[model samples]
Target chain A: MNTFVLLQVSEQVAAKSADMAAKDPHGIIITAVSVSVVFIALIILYFAYTFIGKLTSGQIKMPKIKLPSFKKKTAEVHPTPEEMAAIALALESKRSGEVYAAIGLALHQHMNEKVHDNESYVITIKRRN
Target chain B: MNTIIESLQQFWQYTGFANMTYQHLIMVLIGIAFITVAIKKDWEPLLLVPIGFGMIIGNIPITEGLNVGIYEEGSVLNILYQGVHQGWYPPLIFLGIGAMTDFSALISQPRLMLIGAAAQIGIFGAYALALQLGFNPAEAGAIGIIGGADGPTAIFLSSKLAPHLMGAIAVSAYSYMALVPVIQRPIMLLLTTRKERLIRMKPPRVVSQKEKIIFPVVGFILTAMIVPSGMALLGMLFFGNLLKESGVTKRLAETARGPLIDVVTILIGVTVGCSTQADVFLTGSSVKIFGLGLMSFIIATMCGVLFVKFMNLFCKPENKINPLIGNAGVSAVPDAARVSQNAGREFDKSNHLLMHAMAPNVAGVIGSAVAAGILLSFLG
Candidate 1:
């Protein structure tokens, strides 16, 4: 009885092995085909891009555009020495006025105790009762 | 008094305490562990935090017929999960990846693209292993993509080829991606000599803005012509690249890379996590998938490193590549590239490999997608 059971089990095992062997060829074929395809695709890309790299190596320079010149022709002007002196005197007086104005503003703020805060810029009027 | 007691007993029966089992407890504990590791180790916090919390939310036992679970039809989670189920989220994610990625590295040095191709050997290797383990060809193909170390690609491929295994495959791919530093460092060190690690290649040339713009257009045509099955993923990716490189669609590019990707990522991560209810995820097959995933990752790293050493044999001394950067050829984005930089720095502090590694890193993304398309053609 034991021998008979062992024989049956061995036969089943062999059958399973045969079935697996039948499928192995498919696996082998797919593996070979897939690996080859991957290599071929990437190799083609490699060569293609290598060529591209060489072609673009020098950098594709964009054409330089020349803008139309907009030069304005005008005669040169020179001021007389007297006019220059008058201009300098006017500039000096203007600067002194600005300095005085700034000082006056500072003094007014200090006197009103408004140095630390900004003015609200609102005018208030008391209405008659 | 008897009626009140009856009502209390009925209420107790509907509680989570009554419905819970050891499996639920175990799954909850696993969820807690995921959360703790993500917070404590600062590993893949963006992915792990949402996935971890989703795991907790998924495993909470509830009364049957409530239609509240991710697996149940008409549930909110199931609706969100349709993105993963139908494989739309991955293409959208690829769109974002393309918008964010700077292909100057790959364009500057096209030779590195070969390393990406060689690393894909791991996918085939894992497929064969999965077949030996008795999974059907379609299932094995889905499982094998974990070698790509790209979570979206894995999810995309698995959803089409073997929707049953999508959850395990996504989790395994992401887990390995998160452990890139730990898993890759040792292998990278073991595979190369100190001299090879210290060897530095010439800096990549400057890529023109015109070339950058033309790349997506030409790239889309070439790749799509070769593998029309990959049109959805490849098209979206190249389109996103065009938006970024065109300099004319700044708003669209910003949305593609920023808010759009973030929303898709959250949905993908949480839904994938929720799909891992204990009865579904804690299976013998899940364990086998994890084991296969690790082997696939290790094989990819080995192939990448060894291929670089092979490439170095024919190159001039000045142009010889550093073998350390080879590990970046597995498409884990900046993480794998960062690993190469860190490993190279250990040998010679002056040598910087991050910029160089990114060439193969991005190439790996393209290579994996191509491989995925091939598998889909064969299996799907």
Candidate 2:
């Protein structure tokens, strides 16, 4: 309430605020982080572009699985009721024989050599249930 | 005669005849001008027409119905803008916007989607500059909005962060959107070659109905998890796209396109525009905000173009993208696409890159929203 006290309070507030204003903070770390992130992303994208291009262009070869040869029946004979049941049991046990890719490699390789000429093949799309 | 005189005196007192200021009167007129431009000129009518009306209403020192309790404590207009201060309007506007966008163009062209994400450098880069220049984080975020490339996104972000700067930010966003061609052309040209500019892109492989249907559903799962704040925006946007692609929601899609989005846009724009009180509008800080906005937009455009050139170094000629589409990475939507096409036409009239550019243009919408979410998470 006193005049000197009021004046001193105003002076101190002004001095403190001026000092705060003069200090002038910068966002260097934030700016630098964003810029570096953007730069790194661009590099990753460039590599992806080239790496994918190489795969399509035949530069990258994916692993291939081998199929067993189908042998003809060595000795043909008449089957009993027990022989029929044993064969049925073997067929029933083949549950994991599903093809991962429906367009099997044997079919593709055979089509390339014998079925379709050299130019192109018609790929029929099957609707899935 | 005494009664009549008393009544006249009371009217004068109620009308603030003693306190009426010239600047307030000018703001009222400016509001009318804004309304006329929005209605007649169609300069972003969704927001401007409402904003213009709000400005006039707020500056008139009347309309107690808009905010009855605040007439004496502050202007009724200030009280109405409290929703903005509380960070409600921007997210709502964003929700409405997200509900109207279609992201199929982006899903069909995954490589091009990067352009949209790439253009958001304008928002964050401008933010840092504005902050270092003595503005607070909220004000800096508001100024950085000049890079959102989309008017509503810019308006929405700024209104949430710095309601005081809403007027300058809204005006700047719409003005730059109108000038998307002028701002983007030089950078698109300077960054690309004549051969590159004329590069005819292969038509995109047909996007199956199945791919289209699965795109938004899959996108929502990952993006929402990565940036939860983006859920409001990203959710509505993809949800809208789901409606379009699902082949079963014509009625809902029609409503989103017609009444729902339209109503929200008009209310949101005007409410936002009204926040630019004459006193706030006339400040030196608003002028800096405008300048910083312009700078952010320019830098974003150039950054997009330069980023493509950087990406080109590792790409083979067949897979190489046309750098001209780089500007489309900004979120101006079809407007950025038009700019890309116009610049592309300059080299070869037959070169049509607009369809390709749209991928990134729409992506820019997602990118800016994601950036806003990131900023909101850290700063707000």
Candidate 3:
């Protein structure tokens, strides 16, 4: 249950200059800087120890997986079975007299349409000024 | 002409300047010395210089021995000294200090508020010392708060409870701030071992911007819950932080740090300095008061180091604090942090403990102030 609150503020530092006004009341000042040096040394020690322990314990790598590759079709074209069958059927029906004549005429008219599924053989012209 | 000159001569005689004592001259010189330090050494020059100059002005013989001597209440210094008399100077000074201070450091480390709280040991310890030496409770309280290591707090409380002692208290507070490095070092060493001293702490894990912003807000509530009287001191501190962090009050924040604080510092320094005429300042009591303040500072530092040791027994891995930062737990701001950084670098160049030290360094400020506020509330 944290509630938000508004605040106004300030800061004060100068307090006891009179007593602290000495130029080293006790010689050999053990300053804050000196303390920090010791602390840093300790942190390095800890890190070094952790690193050494890990080195002693293990090594690292990733697991392997294998799969096959598919080849490309460079230079090849083949007709569909249905299209070849349709051509054969048209030729067979053309065996007799009138039927053969009619079949030959139909084949001549729809030869491209017999193999193609989606497009038509048509032409258009555009005129420009 | 001849008649007017004769009248002036008689007026000078009556004003009591012709009867001045050697003690008065000594006070003037003392004032000059303070002025010199402020001007030349830059040792808290702003306040010390004015205070010293005020001493010189107030102690100078204002009358030429004519009209009734202006002793007791009629002196010009007496008029200027009224500001100190009314207990107004300290709070105004606090306003200025409040404005100048950056509370973000304290905000980042909420637990550091305790160390700041711990350093106030000087205030109470000094008070008890003064009481043992026979100062009245109010005056002793003033002296004790002197150990909070803050001048304004000392002045504010002294002005309210011990006006006569205001000069001593203010002078002690400001003077001691300059001496913190010297005074604190010995205590830091004596309390902790070299083996203990060399221990390094990890840098604080990332403290988020949101946490920094929320810190003072949370702190105000925490301190207020404990001591309601600390509201003014605590409230003003957090409020200033709110202005800085809220990102909406750019103008107000600028004013607080800039002009608003500067003017008050000048006035407060001179006014407090003026209050100490040689007649009042050069006494056995002032010497004794200074002694008590020094001892109080050492005690505060010792308590801080000891707290580190006390906590080490329970500290878990990765959470262990560098005890050296304990020294920074006193109220000296960047100076204390610098000391911690310098000390850490001594044993290992890679050591950088200042950022961590700041948590408690700034906390010491709040701790001292809260201690003062609590005293001011209960005793005043």
Please tell me which predicted candidate would have the highest lDDT against the true structure.
Answer: 1
Q: Give the TM-score of candidate 3.
A: 0.67
Give the distance in Å from residue B116's predicted Cα in candidate 2 to where it truly belongs. Answer: 1.8
Tens digit per residue, CA lDDT, model 2, A1-80: 22122112233333433443344345455455544443343334334433444444457887787655433232344688
Ranking by lDDT: 1, 2, 3
Scanning candidate 3 chain B in windows of ten residues, the lowest lDDT window is B63-72
Higher-scoring candidate on TM-score, 1 or 3: 1
State the lDDT of candidate 1 residue by residue for B198-239, as single tens digits.
897899988999889988898889988999988888888889
Per-candidate Cα lDDT values, in order, are 0.86, 0.66, 0.61
Estimated TM-score for each candidate: 0.81, 0.71, 0.67
Candidate 2 lDDT by residue in tens digits, B287-347 = 7877787888888898788777777777787777788889988887678888888888878
Report lDDT (Cα) of residue A105, candidate 2: 64
Model 1: CA > 4 A from native: A1-26, A59-129
* Residue-wise C-alpha lDDT for candidate 3, range B1-380, written one tens digit per residue: 99999999877775536846787788778888887876787677766887787676556654433222112354554444455665454554444445455654444334444555455565666666776676655556677776666766677677666665677778888887766767777677777777777777755444445644555566567666655666666677666666666666666767766676676676677666766766666788788888888877777777677777777788785566666778777766667777778777776788788887887776666666666665555445
Model 2 residue B128 lDDT? 76
Residue B311 of model 2, lDDT score: 72
DockQ of 1: 0.19
* Model 1 chain B weakest 10-residue run by lDDT: B159-168
Model 3 alpha-carbon miss at residue B234, Å: 1.9
Per-residue lDDT tens digits for candidate 1, residues A11-46, read 333344345457564478778888899989999999
Runs of candidate 2 with Cα error greater than 4 angstroms are A1-24, A34-129, B16-20, B36-42, B63-100
